[model samples]
Target chain A: MVAFDFISHGFIQKALIGGFFIAMLCSTLGVFLVLRNLSLIGDGLSHVTFGSVAMGLLFKLYPFYIAIPIVMVSAIGIMKLKEKTRLFSDTAIGIVSSLGIASGVFISSIAGGLNIDLFSYLFGNILAINWTEVLVSFFLSLFFIFLIIIFYQELLFITFDEESAQVSGINVKKINTMLYLMTALTVVLAMKAVGVLLVTALLILPPVTALQFSMGFKGTLFISCVIGVLSVTAGIILSFFMDFPTGATIVIINFLFFVLSLLFKKIF
Target chain B: MKETENVISMQNVYFSYNSAEVLSGVSFDLKKGAFLGIVGPNGSGKTTLIRLMLGFLKPQIGDIYLFGQPAFLFKDWHRIGYLPQKTSFSDNHFPAKVKEIVALGLLSKKRSPKRIFREDLRIIDKYLDLFGIIDLKEKFIGELSGGQRQRVLLAKAMVNEPELLILDEPTTALDPETRERFFDILKEINNKKAMTIIMITHDIGTIGRYASNMLYLDKRVIFFGTFESFCNSNDMTEYFGEFAQHLICHRHDTGDIYKKSYGRI
Candidate 1:
């Protein structure tokens, strides 16, 4: 049995609270992205966040202030590239993702090498989350989640059929841009908790696991959020006791849930 | 809202893709309550014309109007119901139910909150029953067969009971019996509700039996008039030859004409 003493630490509390909000946001957005065949967008935007973070560190500025705007712009750029050109969405994502990582490497070399600060961002250090980040994630997640609720029907319509939704008087372009912007914001917030490399795992695994069950869209969304929060909670506690990386632990737990869901689908 | 006599109006519409010139000098006016069938061969701009009318594509040198408003500026979309060629929900595991899919039809008329009240559910069920799929309301859309899926989508399109309905090759993947039933439903809606309808189809032979006006198009408007005129027109007879033109126009008249004219063919 593990002692409850670690629960009193402010850092652990911050990680738990912040991680919960981030997990909820990622999983909620993941459902739409996966259904729309835009799952790779999370991975793509996270790489852009990496380059922005490196630029911030090189300039001695707060990373998120730079990372947020840059990643958002890159997200829109990926969308516009796919629209203007005849390339498929995956190809566009691949192009943007390659540029992001290549630029990060170039910037890092120009700054001499990858330092401990950048390394922390590369692998994540959720325990170092401050009170400000906790509040920010909480409010941001709540705000977007509320927006999702208000536009829930419109989003579902567009995901099902874009042309029919357009005929229904939905501004398909505006809604699509809003979706990309929301994804960019989620990617930036999730980066601090899971790092650039593992952010996609958080955005993908929960919704996919929920999809294994034969349920309605709303049911799938609800189950995805439950899995997300559960994994984060269990991961933070297990990492505290087992001395494992919190981000990796959470991702692993998520994968385990996915595998179990597949097996459950097979058995029942 | 003031009523418009013409449901759609297009004047000298010209469209091209990469200078290929898919459609040129296309002009037509569809009055209210007219059932118009747009038939053409593949790559003949039937779909493009539909897209332009729906404002999905703009013409380089023509004006299009819907309900007397410019097509691009028309905002009363709730008055129009559309069924595309193929829905993206064709994936075998698309996680949406029949009821949920049908509910999407009523969403366009809603305000920001857009909540589906109990009355909306009743309307959805009524449509499902009309389509004979009320029992499948809770089933996933992907789990249904092609015919059932078409019915569900038709229900979705008709749930709003719009003033005008547009269908793009909606029966492309169904059996002949299912297609017949589908057209029967459309005929009923067109006759009973006096709804204006524009359907693009490859079933040129069968479309004449139901559509009041037939627009035979090949890039430009080859013919746009009532089926009676098309049957009696010497130009159509010359263009399609006696056998083929009679084959299309025969069904519009009586079986006696089909037997007397093209029975030996």
Candidate 2:
């Protein structure tokens, strides 16, 4: 039996847990994605989540129902588009991302749900963590963990050498599609934690921090998970004193880590 | 030269990038244990042809077969390895140890969650040893010199026990002595491992000295056959003029290459 504190209210506990796994999952993938120059996937997928949410609001359906499929399709489409084009991946992602954000706004305007509390979606609200959000975050994070572990080699290969990876029969296109799909799913679930605008911040910052000192793939993963968990935890604690949103705080924490890494690189 | 089964066959292949034609009407076959050297000027289709064979790019006008099967559908990629021209991206730092970089070759083989298995470790160790890179296993890739980096890239190429090894300018950065040692190791591998090599390079001296077969690309394939035929052709003389004469000269001193043939290479 353990003593309960103010933080032990089921919802607060759930938010913390939800933030923990979402941070871990997003940051892990984000580190590699950012390093690979694919940061726009996080940005684009988050907008797609916003689009899905808008659809849910307009049609009076559950946001998750609309968000999941919209995000997944956009994710898969980005992969195909990148594969078939001569354009660099970042350019493709940027184009697709602009379209995603544009569509979300267009949908919202057409549906006339102009008063939608997009604040919850833009900047994360740890206060809004519900039972369902926690469960979804847990399972999705677990699946992401499985994916990172299983397809770890394929992703590393594709990132390193797409041509050689394809020649080695790794299904480079499909694996990239799966990565985008998983990224979409993670972003939508993490919406309850970090919101849309700041989500990429959490994703990019943690991984960059980990990459600073880590040596290989395993080292990168370990350092990313540690950095991610610590940032979110510290963010939540800071939210108590600063009276600010938890997601914003975590991003600031992550940014600080990035700065620290750069300083360390410069100093010693 | 004989009608033995080919490892790679390209028929009338055409490829373009951004509407600029690269390889046009290119067709060739790689024998099971031949070192096919592709040499050309900067803008030639050497890299493009390799990409098409690797199935990373599709030919607009023709077909490519690997291991006697349609290349896109072929799944035995584990037996084929490639070393790209730019082996290290901006992200790859020196802190990545040689063993860690080499282990990436087995990524397609192992799908488990645990740390790399003993068998995987053994294979990596074997390639490291075979490449004479065992001592550098713990060294960071960034810390190593260019020749060392090139050696590490070769080890990465062979780490998966690939039967067909494709290299894009494998010795491009090495000094002349280092290049000789690198080719010697490649010669040894050709004999011992029976590996089929497809290489794209610009150094005529090294290519003339080391390669058994030649595929000369010039926006289109200019020639494809034994080094003797490619070097001594009247068409090659008309096509490359002075350069063709240079290739013959490069080979003249090394009749040792034509004479000292042993094992597979």
lDDT of each: 0.88, 0.77
For residue B84, give model 2's deviation from the true position in Å.
2.1
Candidate 2 stretches greater than 4 Å from native: A1-5, A111-116, A264-268, B1-4, B16-19, B93-96, B107-115, B142-145, B242-248, B251-265
Tens digit of per-residue lDDT, candidate 2, span A137-182: 8888888788788777667767666766666567766777777777
Backbone clashes in each candidate structure, one number apiece?
0, 1
Fnat of each candidate:
0.72, 0.46
State the lDDT at B92 in candidate 2: 52
Best by lDDT: 1
- The DockQ scores of all candidates, in the order shown, are 0.72, 0.44
Residue A240 C-alpha lDDT in model 1: 87
lDDT string, candidate 1, B1-265, tens digits? 3556989999999999887999999999999999999988889999899899988888998999999988888899899999988776545667889899999999889987778899899999999998889999999988899889988988999999999999998888778777777778888999999999999888775566678888999999999997667878999989999898887765444324334433432
What would the TM-score be for candidate 1 when compared with the true structure? Answer: 0.95
